[model samples]
Target: MHGGTVRPRRGWGGVPKINVYLPDDLAEGVRAAGLPVSAICQRALEASVRRVAAIRRTALSAHEDPTAGLNQFTDRARTAIRTAAGRSRAAGGQLGTADLLHGVLDEGANLGVRVLRALGLDPAALAAALPQRPQDPVGAASFTATASAALELAVTEALALGHDFVGCEHLVLGLLAEPDGSAGALLRDRGADLRPARQAVVAALVGLTRAAPDPLHPVLARLDRLERHTGLAP
Candidate 1:
């Protein structure tokens, strides 16, 4: 990382070596911090593999409806997804993250709405900020790559949350987590950063509110950390 050689790490048998390039400053920083680049890369790669596996199970083909096979997501989330599909169809395009955001806002009763409000996001305003599309129609619509990726992240989020049921909140997190999506940017612009939004989600689901911090928060956090450490986390 400095004047010394950066060598390929030795691992389990038959594993190939590959170099991970880093900026001079960042490499120096990592050296100074004593961070293990190989371990970091391995963990990240493993997580990515898990995420890809999850997506493949739910992925729709070219001719498949974007809104179809969404029974894995909650009923309310499915309804909102219909709104997204309709919006995409009316716009004469593939479903996108923007449309997904609308799906979160289509139903006022969605837990996603309350979760956003809890994070100080105005759901109504967020929906209004997106391009308006006709809401009446429900049809099979393909999804943009961005939308597909976001939905994939939604599944990942549900797994991370240890949730058997994928909810609207997970979709909200997915929209906010998908780096290439404008919907994620919109949420971040409204201060819905991934970490806090995730915390807000946990709190909301467990009956916590903005009024005060839940006493169970620390316990939950510890348990979550333990879950990851035990390799039980997704």
Candidate 2:
């Protein structure tokens, strides 16, 4: 690991080369001029990393995540958030996309779990795929930048679905929205894409849609569901 980032052996001394493409003419000219392209690229990437790190720090430095303003999370969603935070703490790392996935699976009774099962994605396997150690360490914070972004996306998903409260299924959708994030990548690699997962959610909740008084009908119904709540799914 070079500077906390895993690198493949490519350049001298186990350094990885980030390929920089250039037009033939430009490449020829640069080669003729013997320009230090590697150094230039390193400098540019470092500057970009600094800027991104600053933005992330700004987002997470607040004691409470801005998503708290849209606090219409159902019981399972709230529990999942708390569970994710707890796992992050126990792992000695900041809350991240993987932790959020873990939270959903940990709860074991949410629509999130059902969606995974319906997709033929094993929740246990997904949880096992989570890195035992933090992938990249960002300093102390309630949630990583990716995690915070996913939470915002979760609210968006809930709103788009015409639901009054956020559900664990929405959290799954949020994580999927951030495909560059760790857990998102894991899910995508396993063929659990967004549309099909939502299809699964809709299928499970179709029975509860009629004559419901509030938007929380699906979420509450899922939580209070006792049939196959432990090992079985929705």
Candidate 3:
């Protein structure tokens, strides 16, 4: 693939012209997230394309694909957020990250929540504890950068261990693995001990490998079982 100056391709009968104008705050967020504006746009577009491809692949699978049906939650979350934001704005309220997290919870993705439960972490709890936005203008960029880096490291760990997809377990592992991350520090401040949890995850992964199943499959399957055990429905 070319690194730069790649032209957009014509598709869907003809090339469609599109433009995205980032708000000043959002543009700052992109920069704070340690991504150039172009990189941010490219990744967002790529994810959308890959999601559609994943749906098509799911439709071709004979066995049940949990991810196939799970994607509706994104659209539902987005719609709920838009609706809530509209109402809030009508009432002269400003929308923020708390509103977004609430929207995600409102979509009721049990599978997602289950994974969090498996790690003894709750998104709702984290959402409540997290600052919706940084109060200090000077630290806003650094705060987001730290969060982004933690997320990236967590994802990288999963992939490096031969995992095929990311789930809530990865998020937990990421937080626990990153001693210097904001989320990790917060968890520590709340008296959560990650050392034991990390050892347990490592042991479980080793045991899973000894069972002779596809390594990635077991990781994902174990995660699913953990979800069900926690009473989260797919």
Q: Judging by TM-score against the true structure, name the best candidate.
A: 1
What is the per-residue lDDT of model 2 for residues 15-72, given as tens digits with 9 covering 90 to 100?
7765665656556766788989878667655644443343244333324442333346
lDDT of each: 0.73, 0.69, 0.45
What lDDT does model 2 reach? Answer: 0.69
Candidate that would win on lDDT: 1
Pairs with steric clashes in candidate 2: none
TM-scores of all predicted structures: 0.63, 0.58, 0.35
Candidates, ranked, lDDT = 1, 2, 3
TM-score of 3: 0.35
Worst 10 residues of 2 by lDDT: 224-233
In candidate 1 the C-alpha lDDT for residue 206 amounts to: 56
Candidate 1 global TM-score: 0.63
The lDDT of model 1 is 0.73
List candidate 2 stretches off by more than 4 Å.
Answer: 1-70, 133-140, 208-234
Distance (Å) between predicted and true CA of 53, model 2?
20
Clashing pairs in 1: none
